[model samples]
Target chain A: MAKTIKVRARAKDGVVTVKMLISHPMESGRRKNKKTGKLIPAHFIQEVVTEHNGNKVLVANWSGAISKNPYLSFKFKGGAAGDSLKISWVDNQGKSDSTTAKIK
Target chain B: MNTKRRLFLKGSMAAGAAGVAMSAGLLTPGMVLAAWNEGAFKAKSVDEALSALMGSSSTEAGKIKIKAPDIAENGAVVPVTVSTDMGGVDTIAILASNNPTPLTSSYELGEGALPYVSTRIKMGKTGKVIAVVKSGGKLYSASKEVKVTIGGCGG
Candidate 1:
């Protein structure tokens, strides 16, 4: 599987700001296919977890109401430059992806 | 008196079982996420969703700030930011009152994280975007109404 997640973490004044973008359809299962005229299945992400320096920082539960190609940004404390940050997400269809970035 | 004793025993037994389960690593995040808040996500109204998600619909107005455009040009992707400076905040939940599924997302912040989240959500129509923050076990909420030029959910 290709890398479906893009993440960046930067540290400033002992605070780390993390931004991530996940590539997913985020289909609400309510929209109809323009060609098939059939309802699209709901295939959005359900869980997102972020870790800083191997410590769990945040866990987000999401629904199909989120926009396609979701973007999320958050902040944390006690992080420094050169620390590792990891982000992972799982969709309703049982598919998942993760990425690791360094705090700069 | 007998009924009360039996209930107490049952509660203690359940607590013991849960402790064992946690010690045995049976309650990992992967296992828990498999059972996402289905009832809350499927609820059509804000009250139903709130009660389903947090078991309470009552919230006190607080200093939670919701920063979003007054008018969203594209309902499909309306940017929103919910933040608060209150201490001991552990959870943040976002809801769109008019969407088919009123609850859009809920975030659990750990000890190292701050009480802030920024993301984009879909709005079916013009409605209030509510941010509910759980701090010190109390729920605080703030909302902003955003006018949508076009509906997002494709009917």
Candidate 2:
């Protein structure tokens, strides 16, 4: 199934601090099968982008060591109440999901 | 008749001794309690963990603010922060949606302290990160997805 993400942002004093969490299995290929003793294929998200008021503010790149359902937090400049922040992510399998939050 | 009475007395003594042993720490309360706790903590899934921690089957959204990267370069140390503007927030918890044990950590906020926390966690791969907050005797949650480039769990 495609990953799901949620974003929450608050704007204050010309800066917006955003918080987000995403759902995914994040299976590392290193895990061995108990039945057949074979390695699992590596699957993970690779990149994330956050934009405030349609302007890019923060970006993050991830490796497999990250636990499943990764959590991220950052701040951006110049967003106000009623402004929208957009967040998008791309996984290793080329799957992507994006969501937006209105500043409150 | 004397032998019969003596044998009856010995049998009664053995029964009394056995009863005393039963009450005198022969059956440890600690072991039973430990086993119960292990079962309690054995959540095979994220939803199960949440239910166990919050004592509720469902959690509402919008009372908590969970922050994490949309993409992490290193899964070993992805930073996470949780904050709440809602008044009377008592606790905040972080859960990895795809982790074997999804409930990563929980923090209890005191009355005087601010209702916010930040920490780093390990990620197995790309997945959703959830934050649940308890306030006014209710549970609320939020989630975001993060992408991992390199395997943090030695993949």
Candidate 3:
């Protein structure tokens, strides 16, 4: 599966700033399909994890209440240019995907 | 608040309860995903939701900062950012008080992760956007009100 997360990491003054935008339906399960008249199955990102140089830096927990295509940003101490940062997420339905970015 | 927005918020809360029920039996066997905190998302009241998620009541801390718009043009997408200098922060959770499911999202920070988070959440109407930070085995919180105008029909 193609993960919908776009990640950017930049090292500035010894700290790394990481930002990402995830693409997904984030269906709340309450919204019904207009044609079939059936509740759309809930399929939202339940967890997100970010790793830097093999060290876990950030993790997020989410629910269907979040808006479609969630946006996440954060900063952390101690990262250098050319370092690698990986971001990944697992949806409620057990689907998962990941991507990596090189710090600028 | 607009009557339609109020009605939608109510509907969300009811659906939130149903969302909890769905998770109970929805997960397939041998699933790789971790279990969710159904109690917090399903709780009707903000206090209840917070305690359920954090496992205890939180104190208002001065080190926390929350940034959000005083007036939102759209309830469907409102940007929120939370940052804190508290040490050993474990998780950052955001809640929209007037939404059917008051708890919106949470972030877990490890030793290397910064004590900051930013995200966009959907709100049902006018409400306070709250940020709760857990550090040193305690929870702290900050909040600000946001008025959401839908298609210029709101006050």
Task: Write model 3 residue lDDT over B1-155, tens digit each, in one string.
Answer: 59999999999999999999878656641263435677887787788888888988656665788899999988767889999878888889999888777888888787677788989888778889889898888888889999988611111
The DockQ assigned to candidate 3 is 0.38
lDDT of 2 by residue, B33-112 (tens): 33222221346576787677667748888656777888989876778887778877766667777666566565544323
Best model number under TM-score: 1
Q: TM-score of candidate 3's chain B against its reference?
A: 0.74
Model 1: how far residue B53 lies from native, Å: 1.5
After superposition, the stretches of candidate 1 with alpha carbons farther than 4 Å from their true spots are B1-35
Clash tally, candidates in order: 0, 45, 0
Compared with the true structure, all predictions reach lDDT values of 0.91, 0.67, 0.82
Say which docking band candidate 1 falls in.
Answer: acceptable
Which of 1 and 2 is ahead in TM-score? 1
Candidate 2, residue A19: the lDDT equals 74
| B-chain TM-score of model 1 | 0.77
Q: Which stretch of 10 consecutive residues in model 1 chain B shows the poorest summed lDDT? A: B26-35
DockQ values per model? 0.48, 0.06, 0.38
Instruction: Please give, for residues B16-125, the per-residue lDDT of candidate 1 as tens digits.
Output: 99999876664454564556888888998898988988888899999999999999988999999999989999989999999988999999999789999999999999
Worst 10 contiguous positions by lDDT, candidate 3 chain B: B27-36
lDDT by residue for model 2 (A1-104), tens: 45488777887877666678888666555677677888877666655667765555654444343557777665545677898877787665566788888988
Worst 10 residues of 2 chain B by lDDT: B32-41
